[model samples]
Target: MSTIAPARVVLEAAGIRKQFPGVVALDDVSLRLRSGEIQALVGENGAGKSTLIKILTGVYQPDAGSVTIDGAPVRFGSARDALKAGISVVHQEHNLIPQFTVAENILLERIPTRLPQLVDYAAIYREARPWMKTVGLDMPATRSVSALSAAQMQLVEIAKALSLQARILLLDEPTAAITPHETGYLFRVLRELRAQGVAVVFVSHKLEEVFELADRVTVLRDGRNTALDHEIKGLTQDQMVTYMIGRSDVLAQLPARPARGEPVLEVRDLATEAGARGITFSLHRGEILGLYGLVGAGRTELAKAIIGELKVTGGDVLVRGRSARIRDLRDALARHRIGYVSENRKEEGLILLHSVLTNMSITIWRRLRLFGQWIRRSSETAAVMPLVKQLDVRAHSLAQQVGTLSGGNQQKVSLGKWLAADVEILIIDEPTIGIDIKTKNALHELIWNLAANGKAIMVISSDMPEIVRLADRILIMRNHRLVGDISNSHDYEEVSAAIMSRLS
Candidate 1:
């Protein structure tokens, strides 16, 4: 562990209170961040963690409160103003323009110039190289931003913030999509930044990383401060979860059971145009069959191909022992009672600019027709609202845009959409990615309940614990082929070792 000494407060939010249409996002909350410290903010979905970050980063103005830096109160009208005040945020979504070069994106605001305000390309690259080196981003400055990987884009975001001379940095779910190897590199950079007296405010759902990297933690629950500011020393993950969810009891766990009856779905010799080759699997009714693999191991591609998103070159999909040919996503959903939930929810799984009700009712409109042609709004709401409530989605109303909701809540909506459509065979990929522990448990329970009600669930995930806890049977894929298949007896180490052996 790195040695550190307590320092003065660099930032503070006092008596914060923010209210939305029908919810109190923050209620008299307070938080303090010290210089040269990593302050982790943790909470369940819709606990007002995002609201607080928005208020601090100038995305939204607080209804009541004061934000101070170095004992001086300041008001920022916009994100640019906040950046000028030495506050910069690295959001989950990349903010850089994809068409721009790495150097151009890093120094976008203050590009170098020669006589007559001419854009100096050489000077821009030279200025961007130092910040990139400082953040340990080892990519060519002339490369396009779109060509970089997720981890590379994250590092570029940090470089851009450093180029702005940011004293206080705010990061939201920085490791959600990246691999563990990339996460190690990110932590190494954070440690170097911490030693340089920078104040980092990290907001993430991963509690293990929070405990490992943060010096102090602030826990929020139901729009109020449970632990406003507490040191991480002597704190356990279980204790932290208790503060966030107001419960110390163990989460409800499902017992293993054998799935009976005929298989709901059977894929034989599946071949997808998206690099999947010779994939074969069978999912029985009321079974939670899990596909476990590393990232880019053809798990998602196989799911998409089965759902008709990608073209299938050679394979057969049998639904309830009958061969089925799908035309597209709509045909797959309507003709066959098959639904697919994407792992990348923001881009593929959701329409972020629309209302939550609208996104959920996307597939329901065709189902709730008055004369088999027209959709009745009343009937649609009556059918979807129950599933929303059953899923425990925290929102002011159905009219709220899903983009404003937390990541976990948005995931709930994505799952609920399929449930609303009454799909018997459901395929959910990465259901608990970037979700808090409490929410993760709730989702697992929901999945278990769905399966108990006779819905065949096929889960594709890279999370080993999720697979071990939720699946009855596990299949491992390595280099686009099924390498191993085994029963999960609630033993994590055994399944993990078996999967690794197959991969090796």
Candidate 2:
């Protein structure tokens, strides 16, 4: 029975190498995927995880090494070629078309073709249902992709992979926005897939989930394979951290700061257009306030209302002891000096097609002119370049489109844009969502420094540990209303209880 349970190698990469203009993106990185096994890939920001995944999925061709599937060498020239070779990647970003129905998005290209090669719409919907069920998704197949939440869209991504009959799945940060319930469902599906002899490579920053789901763990650092193992049962989280960072001393130690000063923001009975109930909160100078809740709990809605992006049906907002009625984002920014980092950075924050310098300087363009009549490109680069450097935004050049950078680098640009704007009150929604650990630590440090400088910060996160680390006070919202507050304690169980109770 033990011998039968052992799996054989389904896919193997031998000495994979890739390079960018100024960087050795991947250097002799080797990975093994066994049939019916889930392999966890753990790494920091520049650890070559993305590079390797791209090579495997044929997004970027490798300079050296070869990929073998079931003991046969294969060269994949494109993502479609990789898919044809039984490799499917569910990226952190959902690639589904928002205007299309779930059924249409699922069977996007492979819709049953008639003899004349016309699309069979009814056949497409029929084929999508069982795939959705394979992942515990039950939304109407006819529903538009635009109507689904982040978690639901994630399920659709998995279903898309399944529709292609993927034997080797590469899931990159699939659970970042997923709730625990949804995560449980996804894990169950992966286990079933493993039982069916499908190999899976799971990439995530969540150490706890890695321990729970991975059959083996591989750590990458500085574009090299640092550690590989078939078992992580004996390794502590601290050990994993050390392997990923290449140093035991890189763990973050929160600075001990004095209590906050005067209140900078006050909300009384604020309600959003999304029907969040009367919500009240206060943010003090040099303080970090965290808002936590289950999916659909209205924490994001509250953030939207506070930022004045959504209409407030009731209540009032006060900025530094003065009654302020924020009817629009312009009013909010001009009067309150508020900065909002949205959860979906691609959609709500950065203009992906624009240059990094342009994205970073757009908010401060009015202040960068010589006589308020002419634009200064040199001055703009001088002001934005340092910020890009400080934030460690990786790109070939400042002229590169923001969309060309990796997910983590794009997020840094988003944050840099807000920092350049010099916002007084910062509302960060899921600040580290989909980012690797190294980048996460950098962002956490940046937020702490911002708070220390007397900027009021409201951190909205689904990650319980993140809220526990940085927030001076934690506010739990459930069903569009404030549930409870926890302070001066780092008990995740307490926060979990509050979140569960409010959600229930």
Candidate 3:
């Protein structure tokens, strides 16, 4: 009898150790990738998943350990070196130049040249076409990337990485912004690449995706490897969560609570310039209202309209039964005590270049002024410290740059600023996007506590289980219109069915 031979190892990192000022980012971590296999690198936030990816892609150097390609030891001095060594990565954040055309960005690393060092525009578009089609991006290659939505931008990033045609591809939360249909297409493409003997490293917070796509799994926790290169077959999601978080009960469902008392926010026949039309809803004090929709369903735009970021073309907004003339975000926060936690947290929620303290205290800087004059740094620190502890944010100190923290910690700071301002009505968009299961549970519990404390919360999420778990009522939107408002029964099947029915 003849048997098929095993695939060869494409890349391996063994005994990796990395450290920062006050944190050991990675310690004795190891990862192995085989050709013709999709390997999942998973862990909770701060578990060294991002740190490992950076080290593998040459964004950071490891203090210890070695990397090997095809049984040959190699060292990558920079990202370019890694790419030259047949490695490419699509990070969690968008790396495309917004003003550039899609074709230009996709072929950025290897723009074709003509005679006399001249740029070749025709060659750029022609070379980018196949990659765009491979990722199922239907837009024209000449379109400006800035005009694309977040989901479309994510697709462009994937296309750009695929254009490299690297032997090893690393993807970090690649499906975080795209719709289910787009995710299905990407999965098909990844499978094709695996069949072509390309090694893939997929990093995501979604467990189902991992099980569906990966051939092997590597689990990390506290910068250490808990499981390395375990076959995906016969592995359960519960086991995976335990490996990541050291506990399987982190996703316990929140208790259902019905809304009561007077409406805190009332939107009547609201129409916005962003395409939301005739939307009407009432949010009561201590109520958790969910906004559910697919990508480009106008969920985020509706939240922006409520907070005055988008122009209201028609209808009225009432707070506490009184007409609210919210002119802008400042008016929404200061005059009306309405706050929004944007879905695009990296760009819209927190200032990455600023310190954690600065980002967390920005919302209340005006309120913290002494005698309506200058604000004291000591006072700012005092105000944000409690929230840092409350949110269990993992950072060296308040002075650390917000950009340096993990995705989950950044999200905490994003929501922490609004909590510091003590906003009565809060709009949180995609609260758990790209975050780990443990941090997600913590945030969900925090949201529940906030609502219990008489704060009305509007949660916009594509996560069906999250919506079913937290929201007292759900408003379904499709094609920029609200189609259904159903009381959440906290049953996943029932809630998901109701939501899909409305979406259809």
TM-score versus the correct structure, for each prediction: 0.90, 0.90, 0.90
Q: What is the lDDT of residue 38 in candidate 3?
A: 90
Tens digits of per-residue lDDT, candidate 3, 1-504, equal 001139888899999999999899999999999888899999987799989999999999999999999989988899999988989998767899999999999999889999768999999999999989876788899999999976678778777877787889999988887888778877887887788778889998899899988988999999999899998889998899999989888887876555566799999999999887899999999999999998889998888888888899999999999999798888999889998988888888889999999999999999789889889999999999999999998899999999999788899999899999999999999999888898899899999999988899999998888898899999999989999999988878888988898777
Q: Each candidate's lDDT (Cα)?
A: 0.88, 0.85, 0.89
Predicted model with the maximum lDDT = 3
Model 1 lDDT per residue over 208-311, tens place: 78988998899999889999779898888778989999886445447655554579899999887877777788999889999998887888888888988889
TM-score of 1: 0.90
As a whole number from 0 to 100, the lDDT of residue 87 in candidate 3 is 93
Which ranges of candidate 2 are over 4 A from the true structure?
1-4, 77-81, 97-109, 118-129, 139-146, 248-251, 378-400, 491-504
After aligning candidate 3 to the native by TM-score, how far in Å is the CA of 190 from where it should be? 1.3
TM-score of 3: 0.90
- Residue pairs clashing in model 3 are none
| lDDT for each residue of candidate 2 in 16-96, tens digit (9 for 90 to 100) | 889899999888889988888888998987799988999999899999999999999999889899999989999888889
